[model samples]
Target: MRIGVFLVAAQFPGMDSGDVLRATVETIVAAERAGFDDAWIAEHHFMSYGVCPSATMLAGVALGRTERIRVGTAVSVLSNRHPVALAEEAAILHHTSGGRFVLGVGRGGPWLDLEVFGTGLERYERGFAESLDLLCAALTRPSVKAEGEFFRFREVPMSPEPPGLRPVVACTSAATASLAAERGLPMLLGLHIGDEEKAEMIGHYARACPKDVPAPGHVAAAVAQVADTTEQAVATLKARMPEWLRPGLAGYVPVDGRPRPATDVDAYVDRLCRIHPVGSPDHCAERLRRTVERTGLRHLILFVEGAGDPAATLENVARLGAEVLPLVRDL
Candidate 1:
């Protein structure tokens, strides 16, 4: 099983984005040394939260810094980028990571990006799906004419194309998962739902995935911090979580700009724990094992760093790779 971590690129008031950059690269190097499989850099904009903003640029950084430890966008919001740009950057990441790149596709925060890209929510939904379709076509198919509502192409072959057995495409939403399955794409789920929702979401994804997709539905289950001590993990998470990682913020924060995320940490945790995996390695591994038994997930993505001191956070990464991973790897 492949194990990866979430890099929020969380930035504090006085914090330098460069620090996160250094930490991220160092973490990937360490992950490679520790036998971890991949590093998933999340994208967020204008928030003090995970500040990657650009996955391909970071992928470039990762390529220059690490020997292995595949680097992938935890997801690149499809609604935010053009398919050509996506294909080009992914090819760059593929080259940078020695072909160890996974394309994490999603229709995330259509509200924020849609406006910037001169689109509406429904348009975002459609454009995101279509862009992913063209992206896959650009990557593998030798020649293609991708004409859709938001994007169109004719005889454009994205070269050095994902450079492999079709780059892994992990969809973020059920609708997007349907889009993926309809086109036989791999699925990557965000660990952001209740138990029933999680199960149902996976069900939809699996039902949508075609039997002919290169790999069986590739499911990635995301979870929050993994530590030796659950108590410590929770405390650290609350203290240091970036703005964007806050739970229910989207549901609460209206697009109309009404004040929201108005609740305190307790409320946030109550809602977030419903979606994220937070506990000691044993507890986390137990949950993961059960989920895999039920869903047969191909990868387990974790958010190893919390809102804590840098040293402690890195230590947590080391601990999870050294301690927690062994318990669940063979399960």
Candidate 2:
């Protein structure tokens, strides 16, 4: 029932990176004004899919600009950075933001990012658990040491001393979901999957979680656009979103020189429109409520920027808060 906006800083066709970043910040501010509970910043590298390379850095900007809304990384790619380094940034943000920072980490794809960052494909393929374990230790323990396969370090005291931080893991598979459950951390489900898949993942987490740990509330990401009528909302997204999606989806490059799957941009958009809350306020609210009921998701982060237009995106955020939220807040 806790609603939020997912900021991708997506560079649509004919838009500059600077403008996209500024608009993303503006969206975060608008989200807080519109009564959103959180703003999740996405991290992408070497692509027009998302220009923001540093989710934590953008999160700092958002936290500084907004007082009430919690700021988090949709994911800081753990495969590309040292876990201790990310932990330090998380701790600093948590301390500075008065515990309003949520650290969400993920094992990014086997993209060229691994090559550029020099982490190699092995890190992305087999190093996530070690990195995640080190990250958790860095955040919770006063002093941390690691002797894992991917990382080996001497004991070092945590600076800024993580203010009781509990990171959310971005889970794309049962293995990842079980890993998160084993650590007693919640999962951040992506926008690509449907309710049934998400419910299955949650079931995996529930079955794998230790008896000593209480069930963690999971977060779900979904596309949302609000308009006076269903036709208007669907039309707006269909027209504007493909402009952003076509190039963005084609930007990924595999690290090992293997060909990546081609995404059918229009077909993907159509799928999202069918599955997500993209319609009139009443319809959007009902869709969201159904999603919550079906998946048992406690938090919902809506991709309000699906229109790929700043003004329309802002309007969507405001309308979502004003009309859609009231109907679904109690769910």
Best of the candidates, TM-score:
2
lDDT of 2 by residue, 71-172 (tens): 999999999999999999999999999899998999989899999989999989999999998888888899899898889889999997866688899999
lDDT of model 1, residue 120: 62
RMSD of 1: 3.4
Q: What is the lDDT of residue 312 in candidate 2?
A: 83
Question: lDDT score of model 2?
Answer: 0.91
TM-score of each: 0.84, 0.98
RMSD of every candidate to native, in Å, equals: 3.4, 0.9
**lDDT (tens digit, per residue) of candidate 1 on 1-331:** 8788767566644567778767777767677676778888877765556657787678678767877677878777677677667777787777756677777766676456556666566656456667767777666666667667776656765576545434445554577667766776666666555446656766786677677665454646555666667776666666665443453143323344636535465666555544556678777677677767766665777766555446665777777777778888896
Q: Would you list the clashing residue pairs of candidate 1?
A: 8-50, 240-307
